[model samples]
Target: MTFQEITKDEFAQFSRQYSQSFLQTRQMAEMLEKRGYQPYFVGIKQNDELKLAAFMTSLKVFGGLKFELNFGPIGQANEAELASFYKGLKAFVADHQGLELRTYPDSNYRTYDPKGEAIDQPNERAVEQLKSYGFDFVVRHIGFDEQDVVAEWQYIKDLAEISDEETLLKSYNSNAKRNVKKAIKNAVSVRVADFDELDKVEKLIEGTGEKRKFATKDLSYYQELHQAFGDKAEMLLTEVEGKAIAAGVFIEVGSEFLYLYGGSDGAYGKLGGPFLLQHTAMLHALERGLKSYNFYGISGKFDGSDGVLRFKQNFGGYITQKLGEFAYYPSKTKFKLIDILKKITGRK
Candidate 1:
């Protein structure tokens, strides 16, 4: 078994065989590279045949090197394969003077109802598999990791169960159905945005970020995503009386159509621009023959306090916690020293 760098296309081809996330795609690799990450498509091979592949990014910060396996190690690997990969990974890190590696590989977690009730409990097999190979659960955060790159907890509507648009709409909660209808009755137009219209799209994003008190990316980020993914990605906008009021960025990658980001003019909340935008994106997902429509991040707190989670639940999708996020320390001593230093400086 060996660890070696492979081409981006090779990594993508291997990953697609599994249920990959948007962050694990070839397009994400390209987009992150453009954002100044040192991208590497590394694969573990046995007998010159691929066993596992991950698109990793190398970061040299806080006086040591770290590798981020954001959402991968894509193919199936048994104990032997994992053992070899970790040994090789340690050697690979040592050669580059790296201290540790972090991975957030998608795997079987669990499913839940729209109301946050557990439908299926989490399976610990994947977590146990990684633990046997030196990957430890981060455990820094209690409930959900706030700094998650992908939605650790996500809401998804499986299109396989739905037959048509009418059925899809009917399956949604009453509030969702009412809001969508209201948007249509109010003459709100929902459509995909052209590349040239990103400036206006970013403006909607900006308004949302401000109103919601969350940081947002600049226009350049959206431009790069559109360029990298082409037709597989889209920015949908909702307009009322010729003025854009809401925007949602959707990516049709892997087996799911993921709602990556959304922005809306809160003043138009009553107009149901957001509802129409979601409905439009879901329609596009159905047209593309995608298996699932992911409404993305939702808080795990199910006691009916989170408005965002409630909004997603209205669409009548189930929630899931993708049991991923593990870290491997190549040299425990070195990793500890850096960890202590960061904490001491209060910069963590």
Candidate 2:
């Protein structure tokens, strides 16, 4: 097998042939590039035929360069192919003198039903192959202290079973159903926000982060995201009496609609504006003939009182546990130094 750099168009064509993560797309890479990361694609070929490809984003930090492969290395690979790809990856890291290469490959996961029943298991051989190539698995939790670039748990609503909005609402928990009704009764309306109105959403997010004591990206980041995603992304704002109360950013890629970000003022909690916003997004996804609506990340613990998890759970979706992130350190000394710094600064 041979590995070579591929153009964005070629990589995109390859990506479309498989179930791909939105993060692996050229648009996402371009967005990250604009944010100061160096984005690139590498394709693995056997007998001159493409077997696998990965989109990687790299950035420079204090210790050395750090690379992140978010929900990527998009393509199905047999054991042999995986081994070959790992070999190429190690060689590339060495050539670039990378401090650490972190990967959150989408393939390394088992799916479970909503009731905590496992319906699938990860590929044992594939996991072994990755470990053989010096990748060390890291356990990740939800929150600011999470070391992984992505969340380990996600909530996915299969839209295929529901035929209409009423049925969808009925599928939710009783409290969710009540909230939806209250939102409509309270005159909360949801509409797609114009690009110029993103500031309203950003401000709402800032307020939420402040109250929740979490960090939020700058306005420019959301601007670039909106531009990069174009029509595939939508900013839905929930309003009461012409005043914005809650907002959500959603992206429809392939057959999936992802709830990427959301924020709301606590004052509007009683009015159920947040619930209305999410419901509207789901309805829009259904109208677009999407297969699933993903509520994105949640704490892996599945605690009932966890506010974020509870909010998403009310929408009625199954849980998907990802295999989590793995790291391959090209320079052990630099990796150790960075680890120490991360601990000291409470960063990952």
Candidate 3:
């Protein structure tokens, strides 16, 4: 068996033909590379025929030496096929003198326990396949599902069919529109910002991350994404009395609009500014005819956790489980050492 890089046309064709669990489009790879990451394609072939496939991307941090492949959507691989694929990947990493290959498999994350009785619900067979390959269980987030308010987004629609006000008032629920109106009444203005205003947007991101205790990339990342995706990426700001109170950084892919990051001034919590910003972004998305606006990660740990669930529910979108990362560690010692370090640092 050998590995080869599949061309973009071949990759696209394969995606349309197969029922893979995850779809990491080639356009996304180009976007990642534009953001200063090294992206590669791997095709595991057997008997002169392609058997399995995967896409890998790495970002150089703290200089080019320290690197990690954040996520790779590995094409379907059975038990033995997976084993051989990992062996080949390990050899490739070794040949490149890579210190480590950290993969977040898009199909599975945190699927098994040490005893391997399926510590989690084993949502799919692929989840078990990941366990068979010996991946550590990690809990990065929990998800939410509110079905009563489910709605689909459309990227292109006749404006005459559903105007902005009609979609905003209907899609966001009655109260959501009220809050937006309250924001405008309370002197909050939402507007799109030029690339030069990234500094202010970055400040909002930092503030939001600090408050939420999550990770955030620097302004350069957002700038690069905007440059690469053009009109699809938007940086929006909400100001009160001429002071920036809230901001949103988002990207639109086909009919899907993702709210990648959002934050507001903690000091202005009384004005309901953050909610206004969120609703406004949703309104804009609906106006543009997006199919669905993904609020990103919701706290899945709390199955009945109303607080977090309710936060996302107001947007009128159904919550569904999207798969997370899976990885194959080449060195047992390195894997163990990193797992120990992650545990010591309170990471799952």
Model 3 weakest lDDT span, ten residues long: 147-156
Lowest summed lDDT over 10 consecutive residues: which window, candidate 1? 139-148
TM-score for each candidate, following the candidate numbering:
0.92, 0.90, 0.67
* lDDT over C-alpha atoms for residue 227 of model 3: 77
Candidates sorted by lDDT, descending order? 2, 1, 3
Clash counts per candidate, in order, are 0, 0, 13
Which pairs clash in model 1? none
Query: Pick by TM-score: which candidate is best?
Result: 1
- Write model 2 residue lDDT over 276-343, tens digit each, in one string: 89889989998998889988766565445346776887888788776667889887887888889988
Tell me which of candidates 1 and 3 scores higher on lDDT. Answer: 1
State each model's CA lDDT, in order.
0.80, 0.81, 0.59
Candidate 2: stretches off by over 4 Å: 108-126, 147-149, 213-215, 333-348
Tens-place lDDT per residue, model 1, 203-282, is 99888666644456789999999999999999987999889999988998866899888888888899988998998888
How does model 1 score by TM-score? 0.92
Q: What is the lDDT of residue 192 in candidate 1?
A: 85
